[model samples]
Target: MNPFSVFLRARYGKCFASREAIARHQQQAFAHLRRHIMPRSPFYKDFADQPYENWPMMNKALMMEHFTDINTAGITKEDALDIALTSEEKRDFAPMIGQVAVGLSTGTSGQRGLFASNKRERALWAALMLGRFSPSFLRSQRVCLFLRANNMLYERLGNALISFEFYDLLQAFDLHLPRLNKQNPTVLIAPAQILRLLAHAQNDGAIDIQPRCIISVAEVLSPEDEVAITDVFGVEVDQVYQCTEGVLGMTCRAGSLHLNEAYVHIERDIIDEASGAFAPIITDLTRETQPVLKYRLDDILIPDDEPCPCGCASLRLKRIEGRCDDILYWQKHDGGLQMIPSDLIRQAVATSQCEIRDYRAVQVGQHLLKIWLDTDDFALACQYVEQNLLMEAAKLNTQLPELNFHQGITSHLDQKRRRVIAK
Candidate 1:
């Protein structure tokens, strides 16, 4: 079957079916994709003889090193990067090499990554996204997507029933507000930080659009930001966990984040078994242009303990913990390094008695920690945060680092919002 047909079946037919059925569908898709990719992609040629499960894992570094040979689209890293960079600089998403679209990652993981997709892939992506993201596929709706960079993948969503608009994040919010209010989009998608800003705007009556479906993407949706956005919008905010690699997961009707098992297979690199925290080793079966077989991602995710009420048998995720790079390392008593989970630090700050509005923790040096707190009572919030962090460190059997409180810390427009950063 064609990719579009597969996407339609997965989106319209089998999405709400039993887990066994979905698994069978995925198995078939995986087999077909493996057969298709092995012949075209030189990077996977060595693993052609090996079982899919026995294949070696690939990472960003490995992908960058073998970029010329890995992609089946016949585009070099230099040419693709040139196109992507030019598009970013000129704010022109229409530039493409033949029928393939080249896009660059935000480089939050230290090294930026490039991705390419042909026309068929973009069409399939649009169909699948519409089926999963749109509130009602039958009814016509308008979509407003705020992104750091625009691409043909998003632009193709515009059709008779759906109107797609891309709002560049680099542009000021004030400039977009008037246009957004005029668009009156039925579906609004933006990063959590931008959503927070929009929430404030809506509260202040600066914007007057009521979207039926609101999605938080690009950034981790903090609990506080989620509540604020949901409360202001008067609707449950959904999330799309997409990256440079592929579309990994999206929120279901029951508000549970379920992995897109039909398009990808995930292997957990477990970090905390008790909490179901692990990094994802993804094998994106739908991708033929750029084969992503056994690719390890840096983002940490917590799998759901119970089955989703919606009964979609795909794997469910409880939460998206920050990146592994954000996990701070501390010196152990035995001269070894011990890692502190970002969740622990977030919990320490979130559970404080003070009315903490926003906060960030940065590990500046080996034994120094800088914290930024945005609250009415900065002194009290700072004191409470310090005490809680000290308690958390004590529980982890590590000495507390020297703590410094900072005020008015902000994330730049071009940078990814990270609550816990290790410098």
Candidate 2:
């Protein structure tokens, strides 16, 4: 299929007019993909006789274990990893196996993931990205993407109208400042941390780029980071919820992130019904080479109770909470463990009286909490944060754990920064 045709279809075509329409589209796409992959992919051979919905959910461990057999392309896990790692080490993204683009995940979740996309997949990705990310295709656009790894999939986004540039996150920030000022890209995309850094540079007059749009990708955009970036750019910081699996969602004009229901079918694994929080079991119906059917993700997402004003009928997300493993557990008087939501921890820190520049809270043990903060008055900031957390815990009728304060918390570009973590 011509990529431009796909782009046009996604942009102007009424692919998702209603909930029923989207459901029908998903059914058709899933059926088509299953038919194409069942015969070629050995990992899915046994599932040929099973109903699509009845198939067992696949996780990262299973995918890694069966990587060679799972992929329709005859690429081994060893070879793919070598290719992806070589590109990262050399700081070159030109290498490819045939027309397949190979890249590695940041390994933030402990195990690095390898993803492969053939030429067609690359085109589809670029087209869909442009269709969603661009405000208007009629006008020319320049995009500067700050990411740890680059691949042909991103490079394919470049065209006459849309120019694409990849700014390696591993490179020094000082090196990026001059290039960013020169590029003055209309669209700036980066992780929340990088966006925060750029926001500081913009505030300090070190970088001058008035991007029409700023997108947060890869990392969870905390409330603090979002406000800082938005304040600096004078634009609502939008987000793209994508992973190695596929492009899952894009923020609409109303600034609400909606899942691309046209491409993927999401099955919510509800954890908290009251908050509409769930881990997504996604099946990317359009993916053929490496079929992602009934794949479970670790990240937790809260659904928006109110309908989006943008009127996109797709499923909307209120917030992307951190990983399921990071959800803290607190012991109650009844000896039952009560769940401490990531949002609650975030709120406690965010609403603290002292101005906190940066912070991280990690449950080091069952009854131990390690708090790191970067602020002007370390002692006062620590006291305020500890008190706020204690108050929050009291509301839940749980005793606050032993709190340890650290002077500063540093973040690295190669890893996803989680404000709240559980060890």
Candidate 3:
């Protein structure tokens, strides 16, 4: 597929009129994949004719284990991982394996997976991102991205018309403020936490940047933080929910998060039946280098059954909740474990009437919860947060965990901000 073809395919190529139309389009995409893409992979060639259900389920561990065979580029896992690691260590992403660019997946702390994208794939990604999410096509805009690391795929977006700059998150957060104030990017992209930091800086008059578009990536942007950032910077925060797998989804013009069903087909792996919460198993139709077929991401997504006002037929989401591994549970009266969505805990602190600068909820034990809040009057904030959490627990009809409150937020700027974690 050509670079411009991705734009054509995403923007105007296919707009399903109904869910059934989406099904038919996905059917054709899978057919094309089975006929052309699957035959190229040694790992999948034998299973090309098998039923969809018969295809193996993939995850980070399995992908890494079968990397060499799974990729069409004929590169081994060791070589790819080595190249990716070296690039990250040196903070230089210029090295390439032939025409293919290799990068590492930054997930929850263990067994970081390797991802490969050929030159064509990189161009397509750039086109899709620019075509779909760019703030304006008519003006010469500067797009600034704050990321843990940079890759060739991200670099592809920089050209004569657009000035694209990547700020390494590995550097101290304070170091970027001066440069950002001077750049005054037209489009600002960063993880939700970094955006929150920037919002605070802007509020304090430390940095003055009025980005026309603010895009949150890499981390889940909670409703409170979104509001905080939007209140500080006058633009609604658009979210791009993506990972190493591919660009799974992004916010539409109506501010609803829609799965990128035009190119990526996602299967729901239900987690909470009552809430209709499920994890995403995605298959990217355009990824020929390293096929992402039936790849299950760890994130929990809450669906919105209502159609978006933007008239896009893609699946809508209420929120991209935290990872499955971080799902907090409470012991039930009937000896069962009941799931308490991390969002509820987030709300317990965020929705409190008192001002809360930041917080983290960690389930350290079966019945022990530790919370740290960064705000004026720490004791008062803790009391309010505890009461709210207990009220929620009572409403849910579950045993309340012991609330342990600390003085301030205990997290680093460089790490992906996870407000709620289960130990």
Candidate 4:
């Protein structure tokens, strides 16, 4: 075995052995972050004087603004971007020892951000995910990875039983489908939207191949999307909340999505007046090349206040609420703040008996709500939804905001569409 591989096995095995042991390991990890990466990086050095417990929270905007100065070992934002972009073009660049891998995201909030991971960091991620999520699969499984770009770090997954074929989403399906269908992969992983499309193709008798497992990544999977995809594919859908930032969480065998305890520590605080769902403030213990210490994320995560039935004792995320930008804001007549909850909007619409396939809500002002409903029974559906909203608002002792209903299909920039927009 390779030296790096051996090191990975040893470190991750110890970390995943038990939750208590992993906490002990994190103490050492935090020490390493303080001693080595922080002092070397100019941005982290500003926080150097602050106690680790008192480090200031950060977000995408802050990271992008001070990108050059925050990276450890004198790594610059330019270098990180160069590696990420060049690697996307298939250039091979070896990351320094203890230097984490950097990946950039096409940010939904208008600007892109960087995600860093070292060798040991990636190993811990793999261990935490595979060890708990897909224990039945191994290096012997044939894996098909569908993504926009496949990087060198992802290339490491190839082994005797674990051969991977990267299928780029941008390419024409006709060019790759025949070859892939012949290979007959044992595991298929793709974005939830793409997986649904694949399921449709199979149902239409376009493709015939069964995989042992299926993983959904990149986009959020609506309950409807999840049910349809799983039903047509005939397998339970596994979700990985991953992006250019980091592998945030993965669905375990027991179906509960668990956070990776070894790499990241997440805290939640309420940012808006709406659902009161806690927004994520992240502390990445594994990032070294560019340390993401106390970074705040815009993507709102649903917290599982209750313990999981799964035996593994790890941080549990209940569900991911849509992004902060997706939250609609309303102006009250009394000049007080009264923002409508996205969850309430979703619940109100979802409960309608009408088959409203898709919809988007735009806030015209603080008191006016412009709703777009995509269904044949637009009038009936709108009436049903408004009644629900009125009932919910009454329960909270708040007036039902005026609703202006429109009938049309909303065009999306990315493959996935946001159900609500803060206009």
Maximum-TM-score candidate: 3
Q: Where does candidate 4 stray beyond 4 Å?
A: 1-25, 46-49, 79-102, 116-124, 135-139, 148-150, 172-180, 272-276, 329-339, 408-416
Best lDDT among the predictions, by candidate number: 3
Q: Against the true structure, what is each candidate's TM-score?
A: 0.92, 0.94, 0.96, 0.81
Task: Arrange candidates by TM-score, descending.
Answer: 3, 2, 1, 4
Candidate 2 vs 3: which has more TM-score:
3
- How many clashes in candidate 1? 0
List the candidates ranked by lDDT, beginning with the highest: 3, 2, 1, 4
| Candidate 4 global Cα RMSD | 4.3
Cα lDDT tens digits, model 1, 1-423, are 455675566466647457777778778877786677767987777777678778878988888878888999788989988888898889988758898888877758758787888887787776667767678877899999998878888897587989999898888778999999999999998989988989999999999888998989878887788999999999899888988887799888788889988788888999776677899999887788888888999988888857888877888987788887777888766776677777777788889898887888899878999999888888888888888888877776787789999876676765678988888
Candidate 3 on 322-377: residue-level lDDT in tens?
88888888988778888888789888887788888888888987889988888998
Candidate 2 local lDDT, 78-117, one digit each (tens): 9998988888889998758887777887656788777888
Residue 283, candidate 4: Cα error in Å is: 1.4
Pairs that collide, model 4 = 58-296, 100-117, 100-118, 101-117, 139-161, 139-162, 140-161, 330-366, 331-366
| Residue-level lDDT tens digits of model 4 in 1-423 | 223543454234432545677688677877777877788788777666577678867888788778888765555778778877776566343433344666766666667776666666666555544554442543477678777555545657566656767776656655667777877777787877678777877788778878778888876777777888788878888888876556777776578777766567777777653444777777777666667878778887766656676565666776677787776644444555565667778788899988887677877655677889889998899999999888887666666668999998745324445677776
Kindly provide the TM-score of model 4 when superposed on the true structure, using C-alpha atoms. Answer: 0.81
Better of 1 and 2 by TM-score: 2
Ten contiguous residues with the weakest lDDT in model 2: 9-18
lDDT of 1: 0.83
